[model samples]
Target chain A: MIAAGLDPIAQFELHKIQELKLGPIDISFTNSSLMMVFTVALIGLWLLLSTRKAALVPGRAQSIAEMSYEFIADMIRSTAGKDGLRFFPFVFSLFIFILFANLLGMIPFFFTTTSHIIVTFTFAMMVIGLVVVYGVWKNGFGFLKLFWPAGVPAVLKILLVTPLEIISFLSRPISLSVRLWANMFAGHILLKLFAGFMIMMVSAFGVFKGGLAALIPFSLTLALTPLEFLVAFVQAYVFALLTCVYLSDALHPGHH
Target chain B: MTYLFDMFGYGFAAAASAAETVADYKGDQDGGAAFPPFDPTYFPSQIFWLLVTFFVLYFMLSRIFLPRIGSMIEERSNRIADDLDMASRLQLQAEQAQSSYEQELADARAKAHNIGATTRASVEAEIAKDVEAADVEADRQQAGADARIATIRNQALKNIDKVAADVAAEIVEKIGGFTPNTATVKTAVG
Candidate 1:
């Protein structure tokens, strides 16, 4: 077995810092939990401090806060229309939380909460749950029309199209959750692997020859670091965008 | 070509070995060693903490942060609109003041022109009346002078007849010793 130090997968390990029990269940606080708390606190403090003055002409930090607000607002507006602004807080929270979590994970030795499937899955399930509940509550039986698209032959609709639509609808949360989790997971692993290769070369070939050989993986790691950063931000954006699109479906499921 | 093939073979070997490591790790996982992410043991705690943090964030954002930013934006827009309205209104007032000033200037120019024309007309009329009055007075003075001259000539004529008669009488006494009457002399001289 590779030592835990060089193991690419080892970074994802959860270490319980505090142990707690709720009857039969172990609900101890772990590194993942700590990172999550840090993410939340960071977001809270950044926003609070940035908006403390709330000047007419925004300063640098305020501009970032306002820009993020407008970015999500524009996303929702473009996808889900003006009415979808009601879900602004929900969408904003999801976007910023994921964004901070992903970015914080990019730091050395930080646990990435979002790299876990369960975490992403939980958020995805919440989004889908909201969609279904809102769609049904607002449209009643008409929400099912999302499955029955317009303009198809009724025969094809019942046999093929409807079932496909239903399956697609059911798969939204899985696709959304898996997309984010897999991106973060794979990117982190790749980074670790390249870094491990650099170290491995140095150890295997001795300092002089190995260090020269390590430059190859080291350069790759350097290149991938920026790409991973891009992936982090893009994944967050895609998650929020998909949420808006799905919510738009809930808002006006009558449209194809 | 051989060197390239060797490099490719090395890459494949490395990848294959990495795969083996991953497979072994998976086998270990199956043997009750949990992979951190896929481990079911950590699910409950992560979910619980996630729920706690996410809701807290949602509450803070919805209740506090979002409204403050939204209101600031709304207030700025409103202030801008009000400022624009005030600026336009002030501009309108300025334009009105300029127009009224121009109007008053035009009215003042007309009044000044009227005063100048009336003064010129009245001065010219007074000058014409003074000239007419001076002409009439000069005419009357000339007629009076003519009448006085005629009377003085008539008196002189009468005096000359008497004097001539007296001279003739003297001459006749000195020569023929005869003198005509004064009345006859006066008729002859007239």
Candidate 2:
């Protein structure tokens, strides 16, 4: 495909196994699904080894496991407040999954499940739906009252209030899903593009000119790699923060 | 699909407004959701395992670990409070005992001083009585001795006169009749 000039996107095409069938459903394993299983197994093995023996003082692996636990716990406590304790499992799972997926994608052959919109969107939708549904369940129909401002003038209420609330509500999934998916997608593509550029530049322009041309893309890729690393962390934090906010809204839905 | 695009358009508009704040353009890629050839069926088994994992962790922490720690803290606090109270009570008892000891000591000292004074006064009076008795006895002895010495002196004097008179009488008889009554002659010459 690369030789045929089929574009970089096609070079990264994901195809499902059409041959495999499971009962009525065509459930065949894809790269993304395989990555999920691999991530789960890795986490299980890590935790199993880390917590095989309870220690008064933690060893290196145990300390890492403990730190990971405490880190997510602290994140939830700070962002979601005291009520965050109830959602520890969900939030921890999300953090571990995303953190591993992003880090794993940095490896050459590993697929990042988070890089796919469907997966990210599904995760986001579940969290957001939980927020809305649980908010309504907890607060009754008063959850919808979160959209309405209490002190607005009666005349401007319909004009001003409706659109803001709609936009805000709609922006939740867009922002949540897009943030993770876009970052992963962009980072991976940029790396591939730079690699392609290095190959093309070095070949098209001979040693002297190629070396000079190589420096630009080479430096850019170098700069972007660290930036991508930073983006991975930031996306995780933002995703967790959004979950926190949504959960907060569920617990206490309104300012006014 | 069309609704999704309209939603995207609205999102793009919002994104455009936010673009002034910062660049929101991440170049286009084919990362959007596609209908995969694989089944998108939910796994009931996976859901069952997930729930089991959540409940096990929750119960273990809540029932087992947290309760033990809570009780341990309670026990420690109770023990500390009991120790402090016991120490305070013991200190108070010790102070009371010390105070009584000091009071008894002062009382004993006062009683001893009074006893010493009375004993000293009695001893001094007995000594004065003994000295008075001895002075009386000595005066009496001196008077008796004076009297005996006077008597003895008088007797000796008498004997000496008598002998002198007799001698005088003998001498007078020999010489002439001058030896008259010696007593009368001695008396008349004296």
Candidate 3:
């Protein structure tokens, strides 16, 4: 049953924090934009404060900075090898932005930038775009070999395999974007619904009946909060992980 | 009753309206349900900020932050390399010092043995010379003693010859004036 006045979708609604138009296009900054800036600003501040010393032996801030740097570096190395260092900046920033966005969404009343398909798709497209451009630039004709792998049996080498591989390659952005968006969207929606259910039950019946009855949704919502937090981390990791996998293909075309 | 038909008609109409709501949400219109995120209206703003944020992050990480961290890593690795090199060099130095010490010890031991051997040879040579001198001195003294004893025996033999001659003469005179010749007596004793 629908909760009377409580709309679960209401939290995702976007409103302009500032209205600024530039030549017929509404360039107004929304809550999502604010969070993006905040995410960037926070990372910038952390890096600034962290490496200010630039010590030979790192302090705590520098250690954390180095750890995150090495973490992304190792991810690329394991997935894409040494050749993937060129895309390090993009992948690193992409992961941090998404992780922060998802975590920010978990905060009560904070907007989830990655929850939007447009946002996630944009990031995914950027990753794929980098892959394609870098692949073509680096590997030339061999880039297409990513789809048509080597050492396939002659029977499977017909038009069947090539088209399927191409389809899978193109589906990278869609799957990547949808996976992140759906996870965040569904988790937030579930949490919102459970919380609304508790509110509905409590209001409909007085203290003992309502409170005791409401306990189920309340506890479930409580439980879901941590799950949503987990989703936030896993989805970000998956997004970055797939980004690295795709980049590995780009860097090494025929080997995959 | 006709009222029942009217109620049925109203129920169908309500369902139809609900279906319309779904269709409208499925539309690409603005102010629709928040379920769809592929809305073109939000794409521009999101894209702009994503570009902006990503650009800043990449610029900072690549140009500023990452390189700084890279240098620190490089510094640490260099320090470790230096430390390792120093350690190995020190190890070699210690090995050389130990070997030289052993070499010196061996040389001193050999020298001590040589000195002991030379001293023993010199002492043995001195004892041999001293014993030879003592043996010669003892031989000379014994020869002298043998010569003296030979002289003494010769003198006693001569005296016995003379006394025998005299006694023979006396016995000749006393015994019936039967005196032997002195020359014959001397010859017999000799």
- List lDDT for all candidates, in order: 0.88, 0.65, 0.81
The candidate scoring highest on lDDT is: 1
Query: What is the per-residue lDDT of model 3 for residues A1-256, given as tens digits with 9 covering 90 to 100?
Result: 4554576556777778898777888777988889889988888888899989988888999999888888888988998899888888878888887888899899988888877878888888999998999999999999989877889875686667877888898888987777777677767767877888878888899777998999999999999898778768767777787899899998889987
Residues B79-106, candidate 1, lDDT per residue (tens digit)? 9999999999999999999999999999
Best by DockQ: 1
Q: Which CAPRI category fits model 3? A: acceptable
If ranked by DockQ, best first, what sequence of candidates would result?
A: 1, 3, 2
The TM-score obtained by model 1 is: 0.83
Which ten contiguous residues of candidate 2 chain A have the minimum total lDDT? A1-10
**How close to the true structure is residue A111 of candidate 3, measured as C-alpha lDDT?**
83
Docking class of 1: acceptable
What RMSD, rounded to one decimal, does every model reach? Answer: 6.3, 10.0, 9.2
Off by over 4 Å in 2: A1-7, A17-19, A22-25, A149-157, B1-190
In angstroms, how far off is B42's CA in candidate 1? 2.2
How does model 2 score by TM-score? 0.60
> How high is the lDDT of residue B17 in model 3?
45
lDDT (10s digit) by residue, model 3, range B118-138:
999999999999999999999
Lowest-sum lDDT 10-residue window in model 3 chain A: A1-10
